[model samples]
Target: MSGQDPVSSPARTDSWSSKIDTSVAHPARRYDYWLGGKDNFAADRESGDAVAAAFPTVRTSAIENRRFLRRAVAYLAREAGLRQFLDVGTGIPTADNTHQVAQAIAPQSRIVYVDNDPIVLMHARALLTSTPEGATAYLDADLRDPGRILGDPQLARTIDLSRPVGLMLVAILHFVKDADDPYGAVSRLVSAMPSGSYLTITHATNDHMPPEILAAVGDADAQIPFQFRSREEFGRFLDGMDLVPPGIVSVAEWRAENEAGPRPSAAETAVYGAVARIP
Candidate 1:
């Protein structure tokens, strides 16, 4: 498999569920395309383009989310001196992935990626390469099933829950609507892990977006409403965790390599990111 082509599967040409219905749009594939990955179908591209047209900040928000993941992983591996990571909702493999960024800082860093998307799982196996001293694995699971993720025997093979681990949910929880009780899901996952572990997240919000842009996005994709929450709602996800310096803020404002510039205009800033530790 070359760099640009989507990773091919061995005898699993029919692996994807027929009900996957590539005719409609999906959050993972659309996000993969936004991150310059090749795992998305034409329908996903079309829908993503429509969303970008409506909300011009979608592309920037996607990129900023990726950057936040890189920065958070670096902090866990370096400053926090963590060696294990459990990245849920792991998207299509892209540059500076969790394993890559973490192992770059500490080659012994071990990481496990979990995602329910077949295309992402295929790419993950192909591209989520681990260092000689590290380990990596991909599990086909959804964020809604944190129990399945935490209790999976395979997870124990690479990560030691007794030790500190980084739990990354970059740009994923927003897709989990309120009825899903995203807060409870997050709490369960964090509670299952041990003390000193870190929880890093990035989410989309309407708190910093204009009404016109929000309305346009609403019409662009009716199937998956891009539900945006307020800053206070986003903060509730980190209630029990020890928030790191800078606390919960916009993705561009969270330990950015560059200086914290003026906040983006309401229409341009729709993403928020933060890191916290379980104590």
Candidate 2:
């Protein structure tokens, strides 16, 4: 990660701080709490604890999902030769962020991160680190508003729309219920990218878990709505795109690396991940 602090532009502080509601438990904060991050509130911790109690492997699943993200980004940067990235639903910053992984392999890589959480916006500086050769920017936007994201001038300035981009939707689509037209939202985002662009997704699934476990998870997630999709349903998100090798498998099973050592069972991971290319 670059040592520079977040951009200190006055535009970032306009109305963003007032929109923060710490009283409610947000998915991003709850995710940070699960990853042992300090940028979470008491409500987030309580919700995270409840979810962990219901699903003992929730933390493991989170860790494995993060590993999947690193692997996917490295592949896009090193193998696919992608120089631009649009990472929507970017959670709180952690080790090997998208820009870090991409810039490490290709210093000229430019990345733009999008998220709607107020806490995430506050911590956006941690994610804005850019290499001297590359650039990074954070946008406070929701996933449902693909048009707004596609039209954002900052995104346009950082990433060239004509070139191939790595569109990362990791662990975020599940939050968009069916009523919100998640499929349409994804298609709209994909449509904005060029032919060579790549889409990497990791979504929670209820496929491998037992009924009792699913019920418990459902109860725990009652505080905040989380729609766990089936494997087939999750696969639909990649429609019209050609999946990369080892298509749409459990998070731990996708390109299992020797560095990560032994892999966990699909039931334990409980998340499906894949990388697909626009044809």
Candidate 3:
């Protein structure tokens, strides 16, 4: 988990049409479609519809995951006294983005967003809007290559490595299969951060889903497969960090703002979320 040499240049041209394959369904684009975004194609809609058909709660899961992200960012900035953030696997920009949430709490908070998707890069301007007091930057990098993300010049300019940072990996790790060594990749990123930094995650899980629903979702033709983990397996990703209160609960139960109204059950949400601090 030691630091790797920085890449000389990590920026890429923002021309996404050449890079994006409209014929195939991309996970990010499909997620965008699920979230009622207009940045998706017919393929994405088709795939997303198929998955939604299989698991009627997929849309709910996506929306709840987003809510979890907003709450986590607010907690990190306001409660945890954090000012720097590294949000990897950032999908298409939507409401209540990481920078927006953090900067709202602390105007001077700095953020660096990382993603390999060409579509996300095309929409990077939406994510780069920063308040005069704070700064924001986007890196066209992959999650598997933590070195490239950690070493990018843009990231270095925005976030200070010596200070505490909020590391966000929401709804993304399921894409990293077991063979890709997701745990090792996450460790490398966490190791690069200074002590007191926090890690926030919201991941899809089958631990609480009914067998029939799981079977239906499993039969969907998502071009890229989702590797749903158990609650215990998801907790392992936060191994070296100290868990916050109400540790590793369903997304709906993670320090929510309101609990008076009826809410989706854990089985319906099918997502796990948590925040932990580096000791």
Candidate 1: give its CA RMSD in angstroms: 3.5
Q: Residues 158-179, candidate 1, lDDT per residue (tens digit)?
A: 7999988899998888888888
On TM-score, the stronger of 1 and 2 is: 2
- RMSD score of candidate 2 (Å): 2.1
* lDDT tens readout by residue for model 2, 244-271: 9999999998887654567888999899
TM-score of every model versus the real structure? 0.91, 0.95, 0.93
Q: Which ten residues in a row have the lowest lDDT in candidate 2?
A: 1-10
List clash counts for every candidate, in order. Answer: 0, 0, 0
> Model 1, stretches more than 4 Å misplaced?
1-9, 12-14, 17-20, 259-267
Better of 2 and 3 by TM-score: 2
TM-score of 3: 0.93
Clashing pairs in 2: none
Write the number of the candidate with greater lDDT, choosing between 1 and 3: 3
Clashing pairs in 1: none
